[model samples]
Target: NSILGFQGNRDLALNMINWLSSDEDLISIRPKDPADNRITLSRAQMQGLFYTSVILMPLAIVLAGVSVWWRRR
Candidate 1:
């Protein structure tokens, strides 16, 4: 019941069910290791990404829209 959110939730549940049913052979199989691929961002890098995506991007989009509107008028 506590295997929720795990990568091998199904396998874990199956193993637990097998163990409970005394199916030792079925419970012999083990789940594969989940990959650990993480990115470590520096403070500067984090700030740069935040500004670029959150601020600069929306500002650029708005400016472009306003410019187009002005040109059209």
Candidate 2:
């Protein structure tokens, strides 16, 4: 902001620094934009999570139930 000569930077930086220093004047809800919040998952990671939940999990449950049933018999 200093190099760009934008006024917004001065307010933002000062607020952040003051907040870090525990200044009472700057006290309020911190600024946040929902659009900036994000979760990034690669395609492979997404596929692996889906497969674990959809396929491997149910198969594990069926195997466990079968083991218990066989033990009872």
Candidate 3:
């Protein structure tokens, strides 16, 4: 019943609704640009992101906890 497109899909959606309503004034402005909709990663970047999230973040937290405990002692 609705339409779909990959690029600039948001504009198509608002236009579709206006068409269905048969009222041109249903929307005076186009919808805001969608968020950066694509997620692209190179192999190195992917590995780095994975390590940062899965390893470095937890390591940093542990280090911070140790530092706090050491300071208290």
- In terms of lDDT, which candidate is strongest? 1
In terms of TM-score, which candidate is stronger, 1 or 2?
1
Tens digits of per-residue lDDT, candidate 1, 31-69, equal: 577889999999999999999999999999999999999
Q: Residue by residue across 1-73, what tens digits does model 3's lDDT show?
A: 2444455666767877897899777655455656887999999999999999999999999999999999999
- List residue ranges in candidate 3 displaced over 4 A: 1-36
Q: Write the per-residue lDDT of candidate 2 for residues 33-71, one digit (tens) a residue.
A: 466767799999999999999999999999999999999
* Model 2 misplaced stretches (Cα beyond 4 Å): 1-37
Range of the 10 consecutive residues with the lowest summed lDDT in candidate 1: 1-10
Highest-scoring model, TM-score: 1
lDDT of 2 at 12: 66
User: Root-mean-square deviation of each candidate, in angstroms?
Assistant: 8.5, 7.4, 8.1
